[model samples]
Target: MILALAIPAILIKEPWGPLVLALGMLLVASFLVWTLLRRQSRGFPQPYEASGLLEVVLATSREWLWTIGPDGRFTFSGPISRELIGYDPSELLGQHYSRVMECEDLAEAIRNRAKREKPDSSWSGLVTACRHRDGRRILVEVSGRPILDGQGQVRGFEGTTRALDVPSAHDVASEETRAGVEAMLISRTLLTAFQPIRALNNGNVIGAEALTRFLSADDRGISPEAWFVGAASVGLGVELEMLALEAALSAAASLPEDLYVAVNLSPKACLDDRVPALLQGSSIPLERIVLELTEHHEVTDYGPLGKALAQLRREGLRIAIDDAGAGFSSMRHIVELRPDLIKLDRKVITGINADAGLRALGAAMVAFAADIGASLVAEGIETEAELDAVRQLSMNAGQGYLLGRPTVAREEWKLWSVPVHLKRPASGPTTGQHKRP
Candidate 1:
C-alpha cells in the first residue's frame, strides 16, 4: 500500500511532492500499527493507545505530526514537535494552533478557515511561518486533512509539518533583507510613482496608477517586487503594502483632483482593517480612489473579499480588476466582483494589432465589460499601432509608454494636470469619454 501511494506521488511535479510522499507513508504506518495493537487487544484501540502508535510511527520521521480537536486545540503532538518547533509534545497539547504561528499568518489562517464551506475538504503545501520557543521565526510547509468520525462528520484535523531548508548564505541574506524592509517601514522611505491612464479615444489623461519604488543607501539593486516578497517572507507583507498605500494616497494630494488615483493591492491587504482606515483618512475623497485588485496572490475565497469591497464601494470607492485575460483568477474576479473597471493585461494587447486572435479577445472583452456595466482599460499600449488597435476595439481607456510612463517627479505629475494631446494622428475621432471612475 505504501509503494502504491508512493508511485503516484513520485509522478507529481509539484515542489511539495516529497513532503506528500513522506506524509502518506507516515499515515499508512500509523494505521498499520494501530491495527496490530487492536488485534492483540481484541478490541478497538483507545485514544491514548492510538496516540502511542502515532508516536512510534513519528519517532523515526523528521516531520512533525499533529492532530487538533474540534475546538482547534492540539489534541496530540508528535515527538518531532520538539525538534521541529522547539516544543515538547506535552507542551503543545490543548494549545491553539495560533500559539505557534506568527500573528499575520494566524490571521490569514483564520480568514481561510472562515472561508471554508466544507469541513471535510483537505489542504496541502501551505507555506507559512512558525514561531520557535526561542522566539526565532522558522519557515515551514504544512499539509493536513480532515479527521472524520464514524458518522462521516469532521471530528478534527490531522497534519504534518516540516521546515523548509534554507542555505546558510541565503538565510544570512534574508535576514539582511528583513532588516532593510523593517528600516524602510520605520522611516517611511517608500517612494510613490504615478503612471497615467488616458482616455483611449481623445488621448486625455483621466487617471493615474500608483506604483511603489525603493531606493536606499545600502541598496543591493533589489527590485520593488523583491522587496515586497522579502517583506512577506518575514511576515511584514501587509504592513509594507499599507505603507505603500499611505504613501501613494499622500502623493495623490498633489495630482489633479478630477483624475482618479488607482492603487494596486492584493486581496489579503484589502481585508486588513487598516486599509479602509487609511483610505478614509486620506485628503483625497474616496470617490477619487480606485482600488486595483492585483494578481500578486490568488484569492482562495471571494465571500469575505466581496463583502469587504462592497463596504468600500458603498463608501464611494470604485474597484478595478487588474490583469484581465491574464488567467482564470482575474476572470473570476471580474465575474464575482463586478468591478467598475476591467484592465486588459499586456499579454492580450502586446501584438494585438497584428494578431487576429488577440484582436478577437480584445473585442470580446470590450463586449463582456459593457454587458457587465464596466469600462475596459487596455494596459501596456506601447506602440501607435497597438493604441490604434485598442482604440478600434473601443477600449475605454489605456496606459503605456505610448500614452504615459510611470514617473515619481512632481513636475511630470503637474504636466498631467493640463492634458497634452498625443502628436500621433488620430485613428479617426473616437467618442469615448472618461467617466468619474
Candidate 2:
C-alpha cells in the first residue's frame, strides 16, 4: 500500500518512489535477518542442570565405565575408569583381562567370563586382584556384561570395580572382647542358642545352626562380653566346644531324620585334642554336622586351623567357612579348606539388587561357590529384592530376616527355635551355674 501510494505520489511529482522502495527493501531484509538469527542462535543446555545434555556425560564420566569389542578387547572407557583402577587408556584398550588379574584367581574368572561370554548372562561378577603401580594388590570386585557388536559376535566386556573390605560382627564387638577371647583357653560359663536353618528348595526346616550365646549368672542384663570373653578368659574354648557338641548332638536326636545341625567352632576347637574323641559316641552322626569356623579375624594360625579342619573333614564332619566375606581374605582358606559351604556375608548382600554392581559381585561369588563344589548361602536376605537377587544369582541357600528370626532354647525347642547360645547354665547344674535367673 505504501509503495503504491508512493508510486502515485511520485507520478504526481512527489519524488517518493526511490525512498519508499529502499525503505521497503530494508524492512524485508531486516525481517529475514531477524528470523534467521532466531533460528540459529538457540541457547545450549547448561551442565549444571540434571536434564541438561552435558549432565549426562558428566554423570557417566564420574562412574567406572568401559566397553569391550569382540575377542574380549577393550574398546572404550569412562574417564573415571582410570581413576578407579589406575590404568591408562593405552593399557586397557586392547589388553586381555588376565594380565591384570591375580594369577591364581584369574583362571576361574576366565572360565566364568567365557561361559558368560556366549550366554544371556552378559553381566557376571569376578573377584580378582589388580596390581597397583607400586606392585601392591588392590582387590577389586568386578561385574561385567559382554559387549556385542552389531553383528553380535563374541565381543569384549564392560564392567565396574571397587575395592572391598567386609568386616564381621566380631570385628566391631570391641577391643576388650578380642583381647579377652585370646586370653582364655577354658570355660565353664559357655552356653549356646540355636537358629533354625530352613531349606529354600523344599521349604522344610533342614536343621538348626548353633550360635554361641553366653549368659551372665549374676544378672547384668545378659552381658555380651561374658560369653565370648569368658570363654577366652577361662581358657576353656575347647571345653565350651564340647558343651556345644553335646547340646547339638542331644538336639539332633529329636529333630527330623535328615536334619543336620551346624555348630560354630572357635579357632581353639580346631586345635583341641579331644574334639575328635567327643564326637565318636555322639548321637549325631559325624558326617551330618557342619562345623562353622568362627573367631577367625586373621589367618596367622592357619596351620593349626587348617589341620583341624582337615581332621574334621576326614572324620566326616562337613566344613563351612563361617562369615566367609568378613574374616580375612579367605582365598587361602577356600583353597586349603575346600569347605563344603561358603556362608556369604550380609554386608555383601546388602542392597545387592538395587545396585546392579553388587548383584554382579554376588553372582560372581555364587559362581565361585559352584566351581568349588560348595553350596552358596547368602546371609542377611532382609528384603524381597535381595532374595530375588540371590535367586537370580542361582543361589541355593539363603538365610536372613526374610526367612526367619533367631530364637532361644526351651521345651518344644522346635517352637522356640532359639538362636544358638554361646554358654547357658548346665542343665543339671547344682546351683549358681551359668544360667541367669
Per-prediction tally of clashes: 0, 33
TM-scores, in order shown? 0.59, 0.50
In model 2, which regions exceed 4 Å deviation? 1-191, 222-226, 233-236, 409-437
Cα lDDT, all candidates: 0.76, 0.56
| Model 2, span 381-434: residue lDDT tens | 655555666666777777764565544544444552333321221233121101
Relative to the true structure, candidate 1 reaches a TM of 0.59
lDDT tens digits, residues 1-437, model 1?
Answer: 75758664775677877777677778888889998977967765477698988667888889899998775568899898899778899988865564565323433333344344344367665556665664345666677888999999888889988886632435785687578888998888768889899987678899999988665544333346545656776778888999999999999999988899999898889899888889999999999999998753356899999888787799999999987776677888888899999998765776677668888999999999999999999986766777778888889999876677678899888888785665554565222211100
Candidate 2, run of 10 with poorest lDDT: 428-437
lDDT, residue 179, model 2: 43
- The prediction achieving the highest TM-score against the true structure is 1
- Full-model lDDT, candidate 2: 0.56
